[model samples]
Target: MTGKLVVGITGASGAIYAVRFLQHAAQYFDQLLVVMSQHARSVARAELGIEVGDGEQCAQNLLGRPYPNITFLN
Candidate 1:
């Protein structure tokens, strides 16, 4: 079977959930896409001490390395 997973990270108190979900999804999904809202970027900076820019590059920094079917949408 083939599948895709779409995860949206919002600006809230549960940012870790998104990260954990991404890690888990990376293992199972054929295509994993994570989209972070602008507010979520702010939240990430505040909570994770990571600065997210306005493009895919910032997401790349956060995600680290590259997975074949993983995509980060800023």
Candidate 2:
């Protein structure tokens, strides 16, 4: 996938960084793929106060809205 951005969200201290990166990547890449680990959800809830469930729900929760070019990889 040329010019595509793949983001993996793990259990890191800076969930904000991932959020900001996604915002910026969305503007530049035509295709954006996001993979969120289970630990990432736990971190997000603790750090960002966001509870992300599994599968597409987790992706939808983080993104707020589904974009045409955005793909959620479970």
Candidate 3:
């Protein structure tokens, strides 16, 4: 098995930063744990216009690829 890492993203202006970081982290960790705040979600929608319907759909949008080592939590 490989190692893991945790990434927490709060309701900050730089929402893309978190996603971009995770995209890059895909190669570094076997498991990538992600946590996002309500404000972050709101900001993401407002800024990126990414209509992430439900939890599962939102998960797909954030990762932007197949279900890889990524998780989304509110």
lDDT of each: 0.72, 0.77, 0.72
Error of 3 at 59 (Å): 3.4
Query: lDDT tens digits, residues 1-74, model 3?
Result: 37888778778887778767878887778987777777888878887776554565666776577556766655
Query: What is the per-residue lDDT of model 1 for residues 8-72, given as tens digits with 9 covering 90 to 100?
Result: 88888776677667777788889977788888888887888777675456545555545667677
The prediction achieving the highest TM-score against the true structure is 3
Best by lDDT: 2
* Candidate 2 lDDT by residue in tens digits, 8-36: 88887898788778876887888988888
Count of residue pairs whose backbone atoms collide, per candidate? 0, 0, 0
As a whole number from 0 to 100, the lDDT of residue 37 in candidate 3 is: 75
Clashing pairs in 1: none
Error of 3 at 28 (Å): 1.1
Candidate 3: lDDT of 38?
A: 79
Q: Estimated TM-score per prediction?
A: 0.77, 0.79, 0.80
TM-score of decoy 3: 0.80
Query: Per-residue error at 23 for model 2, in Å?
Result: 1.0
